[model samples]
Target: MEFQQTGELEEDVWFDDVDPMLLEPSNNLKQRKLSVALVDEEGTDGLTKHVAVDCEMVGVGYKGQESILARVSIVNEFGKCVYDKYVKPREKVTDYRTDVSGIKAHHIQSEAVLRKLLALAMRDIQGQMPISRTFQYLKKEIYFSMTFKEFKDAYEPCKKQVEGIFLLGPLMDKVTDFRRWEEFQDVQREVADIFKDRIIVGHALSNDLKVLFLGHPRRKVRDTSDYKPFRRLNKGSKPSLKKLAQVILNKTIQAGQHDSIEDACVAMKLYMLNRKEWERSNKSKGVLKQTKYFCTNDSKSIKDEKRRKIKIFKIRNLQKKRR
Candidate 1:
């Protein structure tokens, strides 16, 4: 609890040196108004509530160009870790981005001993392991302890030495077949549940959201790098989160070994510093305005609506000709 307060104080200091003109809360007073209602009828879940989210991704695909989410962290406005987990991507990982992501296969690797214990637990539950092992539908938990020698014997990630830099070798056949692993599916589902519907605030949020394959309304996202007030500070281009924190707050962040929770904490703090003013300005942003929709459940009704619109267009054209 004490740590939370100290951290908040530090965040206040992060922005203390920014130009006073940029921090004027009164700048948005003219735009303040009641925001559009978060209607349940729209079926939007987690609309008003805010949760700051950040993701650390590993590179995949040709020459490690494509990004895949490796880890995700989320925090509420209070600077608490809501969720943090290592994810196994559906595609094969090509680059771990160890310098920034600080993630290695061992961090998320399935321990052989643990897997053996888990197999035992499943066999105990069902009286027999499923002979059909094409899919690892079996999911179970077990606790154990073993000597270091025993652990080393059970697991080894092949490594290659090159010019003083060690690189991870190709994943074993079983590791590549991760889709069959129940834990992988579980991690994906669990993370998606927390992030998919919530108001996700972050830095470089669009990229993070893309990697996660999740969507939140633009109005619901607070992106530190793109905030209008920071345009000059960022030179009208997307700047690094580290740059923004350093330039505006005069505090350095992302120093080493990216900590998702810490990144989320800073992003949330940045948003909170200008929350009232930002929301007020957003009141008039068209993307933030809710639109009325004529929704229907029936597919037949959708077809009828389209047909009616076309027929009405023809009728209007004939009327114009007659006139």
Candidate 2:
């Protein structure tokens, strides 16, 4: 079906039957708020380095046996819990997903609150820092704004300088959000318009592109999911983020449920780990020249006594012999 998306949708409209726990715990509403002076740390600018988003859906069986998304959760790259919201489905909640999602019909009577919470969470994660060029969606589209060399340099951007938006699903296709295909289209346009030819670093990123409908060129995408380090020691279809995090970072992740912020950080760690190996393999330096020569093939070796040598004593002699 051809889906038409409009950008004029209200930012404040709420969904009915959304769960409250999906909204992240706000620091402002806490009983005890820790007070610490904002001090400038050395060699570090206070800015978000990455954004990770994961969706927890109330999957309901429909039309015999089909699953559908009912809710979602999002987190920042700093491993900070940011956005969580339960969406109210248009249809009745089936008996199957109640145990898994913990979201019943009673939980999401108010959609307005959930919508406000999500908008705030997105703003909170966005903060005041400007978006990096690495988040660019298309290179040619951005060329008029910035030079190709300038955009190319952004491919391997510094963590402190770029905001990496990490997603849990495949990269090639956009997820159906808010029970409205329009919402997905709007998000895609927004992302593309904001970030044009910049780098997108993630795991199994080919799938991510499939999910996002983004066409990331080779050398522009840093896919940790495809890279295999310690190949002789480990051989498989690339390790899971949870396993890699436990082994490399010495931390536990994807515990209880999956978090996108943690996933993004894990992807970055995997990329960094494999980057050293890539460098080692590509290490070649110093000046060099090229030369080519043809060798004659002989089936059998000639006896030394019967061997003879033909030599041109001078360049003129060689030219005369050729002539």
What lDDT score belongs to each candidate, Candidate 1 first? 0.57, 0.39
RMSD over all Cα atoms, model 2: 30.3
Q: Which ten residues in a row have the lowest lDDT in candidate 2?
A: 287-296
> Would you give me the overall lDDT of model 2?
0.39
**CA RMSD of all predictions:** 18.5, 30.3
Off by over 4 Å in 1: 1-48, 112-185, 290-323
Clashing pairs in 1: 14-249
lDDT by residue (126-199, candidate 1, tens digit) is 42443233123321122114333433333233223345332222222233322322344576567667755566
Per-prediction TM-score: 0.54, 0.38
lDDT of 2 by residue, 210-248 (tens): 333445335344555544342211233455666655555
Highest TM-score model number: 1
